[model samples]
Target: MIDLPIDLLITNKNKDKTVDLILSFLSKENYPAIQKITDSLMYEASGRAFIKIQTGCNKFCSYCLIPYLRGRSQSVPVSQVVRQIKTAQKQSVKEVVLTGIDISQYQDGKAILTDLLKQVLTETSVERIRLGSVYPEVFTKDFLDLYSQNVVSNVKNGRLCRHFHISLQSACDQTLKRMNRHYTIKQFKKTVAQVKKAIPGVSITTDVIVGFPGETDQDFMESLQNIQEIGFSKIHVFPYSNRPGTLAGQKEKKWGEVFKKTKLARAKKLRDLSKQLEENFRKQFINQTLGVLIEAKNKQGEWVGWSDNYIKFQISNPNLKRNQIFKICLS
Candidate 1:
């Protein structure tokens, strides 16, 4: 097997030359993409599987190089996606996460993300499906409808997991504007509120950049305040770093250095708040039962898996085995 990084496989222009060299060495044709492979491969020993439905990014967020490095957003055909899921089901895979660099932009011909989801639900017998990080604007009527009709209504059946990890890089409007994010804080709030209303007990998580180019003290404060108000169950914190070709990277050179210590301090504060928010969100589900897909045992020798709401659960039951779905009560 080739050991090339995923980025090289996806973005390298000289892939033909690389493959020719490999073929000369090994006397075999090289298949660059996994989807191109026409043979049955061993599924993961774990119950869960991650299927890449889309890749690359089109948003061109100022802080990101995904567009330059990964190229434009491209989606796997819906037929291919369905076939993969069906294969996974036949292989006894219990759960599948429709993953991508930016799955929010998934489109295949006339079919959008919602349409793909509908097809997967109807055509495949996969027990659980989850999504990768999504843009705030992805909450269109059709997307919400799929959740309401297929997901929320089938909570008992565990068809789709009710957790969303939104790509909210910065909560401050000014910082977000500088980052070239399409949606405003107001729009994000509205979308989030709508999601909460539609699916009660849905877990909302997000990514936050602690320090961005040209972010003032006031901007940081605004972001922190808004984050608290939004009450995200978990936060993935990133302290801004310069990438060679990114607009934010060039802007950072002109904007002068934000103290490394200062960035760490901000990150620490946000992380502490995340712990509190997560605790609070989990507290609400205390004494409640959730359908958890048993993945495997943790390092501590306890059975570990994730609930439908994306909360991690650890149990020490000796009778439990892998690939089993059980309704577990939170203590």
Candidate 2:
């Protein structure tokens, strides 16, 4: 244990002062990202394991600690990933999600996501694959070329045609600059435009940080407007946390206390907007039959899983086993 301090402020859904439990966001815990993917695949998985090919980021965005915490851009090697996918086939797992702290940046020589995709689809027995998250800058022409023409054309099997999370932190150029994000709003828009043109019904999701110390109302409004315009399938919104050893953490000593009340209010608002966006996004997929890998069965007796496009499916199949893949009709 790193021995987390007991004084950490724990809160509640109501935003009121609360009790303890450092129960991390399961998605970003201290656990190895690879293990997380594997566990999700083995237990929570409906049918396939998530293969984490890379760890860490060299980008070092001002607000992120991934470079410090997860370490630099080292890959798990393509051969290893291929081996794991083969094991997945023996387990009868039908899908594989390519995950990484920086999935788009995974590279070793001429091979990148394009090369990885070609291998997984053409060589592997996994029937479907979905990306974890990718930086927009990494969504190169090779990616667009495949994602566009393929209305499932280039896919050999188990590779998604129109899905990716493009980490759009903010819609305002100024906000993006302050956040140390590499791409501008214009660049992001241009990239997304090409993706949309290439793949109809592409699900582009993003992350937006609200209440950065210097963000003005205009900046906030601009981010919201951009979210609406992008028509994101899901928006993972977070209130900026001033973690130690980072630039934002360094500023915490100088800048006055961030209004916890206000920032949470903003997060809540954005979450509401996110749900609305997801609802609208889901409407397009009503009656859609998507390849689903059953992850876990809830206590409510509903077995749920995510489609290749990451659309959640709540199938009411009680006898279904976890880590099994099936094509389920999306309502």
Candidate 3:
């Protein structure tokens, strides 16, 4: 652990040091530490645990400051990740979420994200392994095939969770190019189609940014139409706001910033679509049995938790214990 633990509080530059500081507190000398613990430090007395498997982003998308603020992508060793998950399992943790700033870029020597996942699955006995936001470029045939065989087929036993949160900022090719996105909309569509075909009843979610600088009316419409066509289970919508020192921020004056009112209006349109899409995705699972990990009882005296596909739900079963998985049927 580093000597100056207080540095974590002052600035964002010391992202790597913060990991060391967390390990110093959580682990004794005999125990090991993951270089990266899911994106942030999130631990609860419930069944699920979050571990940052990687940190930082190499994809300096024009609008984002994550690369400048957090530095380049760095992955935790596979052995360390497995060790941490095993320790959590010993503490009765039933679910482990592998998270990061950009886990899709995770690399430790020759091991990539898929390799790390395989190691975790083979070495640990965590009931569920959920993933954080994965960049679209990582979804190669090899990766999808591995997921189909190992994660989708083994859903009955609750291994890897059957949910994908893809980081797709825009659907219009021109807007995406301006935003410096690595993959085209067509590539993303193909990947999603492949995953959907491989895993039945899978939940796919995504993020979208509306009203980016210089985004035309046609561009906005394209995003809306394409997103609806893709049919994501849910979407997290964001209005474009300039981040200081980023490429988009510098080009704001030249590109002409999107009007505040226009941004809000566009955001509303996307959000409305999100609601419809979410309802449509959830409709298929109605009355179907799902594996749910009971995390806690809410203030309403009902057990609240998430289904294996990442749906938040509540049940009124008094016999259910905290930190346990149960087969629950949706009504």
TM-score of each: 0.89, 0.80, 0.87
Clashing pairs in 3: 36-52, 37-51, 37-52, 38-51, 38-52
Q: Candidate 2's error at 97, in angstroms?
A: 1.4
lDDT of 1 by residue, 21-76 (tens): 55654654454532431222235677877787887788999888988777898888
Model 3 C-alpha lDDT per residue in residues 1-331, reported as the tens digit of each score: 5677442242353345666756765565422333334334356788788887888899989988888777899787888888888888888898888888889999989999888888887888788888999987777787777677767324445487889899889999988998999989899899889888877777899999988888989999988999998989999999998888889899988877899999999999999999998888777878887778888888999998888787777999889988888888878
Error of 2 at 279 (Å): 0.4
**Winner of 1 and 2 under lDDT:** 1
Count: clashes, candidate 3: 5
- Cα displacement (angstroms), candidate 2, residue 193, comes to 1.9
Model 3 TM-score relative to the real fold: 0.87
Root-mean-square deviation per candidate: 4.7, 8.1, 5.0
lDDT of each: 0.82, 0.71, 0.82
lDDT string, candidate 2, 104-123, tens digits: 88886778877877676566
